[model samples]
Target: MGVAWPFADRNEGFREGLELALDEINRQGVLGSRIRLIEKDDKSSVTDGLTIAQAFANNSELTAVIGHRSSAVAVPASKVYDHAGLLLLAPSSTAPGLTAAGVDRVFRLIPDDTQIGSTMAAYAHAKRFNNVAIFYANDEYGRGLANAFEDEAKAVGMQTVDRLTDYKDLNDLRRIVAKWKLLGCDAVFVAEVMPDGAKFVSDLRKAGMKVPVIGGDGLDAAALADTAGGAAEDTVVASIFNPFAANEAVRHFVRSYEDKYNEAPRKWAAQGYDSLKLLAYALEQAGSREPSKLAEALKRTKSWQGASGPHSFDGSGDVRDMPIILKQVKDGAFQYLTEGARANE
Candidate 1:
């Protein structure tokens, strides 16, 4: 396994989870040979990630590469693996066109931004928020999700007052909030990562706009709550994993992860664990190190149990139509909104 280490602090949990899975798989001798992990720091930069990926592609000992944290990095870096016939398993990157780039070698563990976009739109419409305004980052991750949300929101009889993607200053966000207020938008959806997402929400609150601010996974960072402070209250977020899930798989992962790291595992850590486990399953079933054979085995995966839940990939290498749940930051911590949860809830 080859893993990308951008910010060690941000990815240490993922590394820990991958190491745990690596240990288990090695102990079980699922691969017929002990699996080893080689890591590099992309520094979360696109250029650096690409360089790291190129290095990994040349390493004949590695059968697969595990990550690139951001879509910006993953989209381009995945192409290297595609041409090299190496499997690239993305645990966090969610850009829409990743697997669709004619790259059969790329697979991601998390739901795509497109899924998140549709989920957000449907949730807003279900809540009777007919008028919406979106403030999304202008990058691939944000833009892809925003476009999907726009399509779904329009399809569901929701009215889009505005979709603001250009804003460099706090006053720009203030003005956007004021415009949304004037337009009487019932909800505001944000598709950006913090602290930018948090800054927007905090500024919106400071501007005295009380409309519900719903965010995508880009805003799932803890900084969003800390930066937005009281403004984060009632702010809903769309997520694939429910940390509070009572299932045995989830509980066991939570317990073992905490026991190993002396702290709770982040979403990426659980996803990293699941991705490695899934890879191990494919390797065991395929009984080969060849990429094509491994991929064929992986495509047949159905309802495979993971820390997050049961997962199966669609033809496009996505977990299409997977359950996306809504959670809110109540008081300070993220609280599962049981009041109007989705069917999966």
Candidate 2:
């Protein structure tokens, strides 16, 4: 097995979870012989991701890989993994096109952008945020999710007041805020990843534009509150995993993860653990190490519960009907919002 993703501190929990799962899988003798993990830091760069993909593909010892966190890196790398006949499970990449490419060996553990975006849009509409503004990154993840949200918002009888992309400077963000204010947008949705995403929220609050802010999983990080300060408060984020979930599988994983890492697991961590365990299950079901057989086994999976949630891949290699959790930042932590709780509450 090969693990390739950005090794930034922001994703350290993911590494911890992956290592913990690897330890458990090997200890349990899931594959008869011990399975080894070769890890590569893609640095969240497209060039580095492609390099890791090619290197992993060239290795005859590696039959499977949990690869790339962002779709910008994952989508292109999937082609390389597929051509090499290696099974690739993307733990967090959410661009809809990741599974649209007809790569049989590529599977996504997280729900796609369409599900994530529409979930957020529906939540916004339910909250009476009838007029909203969208600000998204220029990358694939941002563009794909932004489009999905826009479509869903329109369908749900909500109007998108304004849309902005790839703001070149703080001035651009300020301009966007002013325009949104003038347009009477009740909410704002940001679709960029960390640092930039956090920065945007921070800037918006600093500029005194405090309409309700919402985002997809790209903004679902513990660091968001710290980075954005008070600006992150009341911000609703859509995620695949909720640490406070009542599921028995989640409770067990959380206890074990805290025992090992001395901290609560985040969305990425849970998904990483699930990816490895799912692969191990597929290996056992296939009764062979052949990549083709593992791929078939994975597609045949149904109601396989993981630390995050139940996972069953559809024909497109995307997880089917996976639950999306809505969380709000409060007192510098993410708390799962019950259906009865309002976005601000």
Top candidate on lDDT is 2
| TM-score of model 1 vs. true structure | 0.94
Q: How much RMSD separates candidate 2 from the native structure?
A: 2.3
**Model 2 regions more than 4 Å off:** 168-172, 339-345
What are the per-residue Cα lDDT tens digits for candidate 2 across 1-345? 999988774475788889888888999787679878899999889999999999999999998999798799999999999999999999988998888988999999998889999999999989999899998998899999999999999999999998887676777777777888888888999898898899989988876688999999999877799899988998999877766667789889989999998977777788889989999999999999999999999999998999888999888899986789888998877777855333221
Per-model lDDT = 0.82, 0.88
Off by over 4 Å in 1: 338-345
How many residue pairs clash per model?
Answer: 0, 0
Each model's TM-score, in the order given? 0.94, 0.95
The global Cα lDDT (0 to 1) of model 2 is 0.88
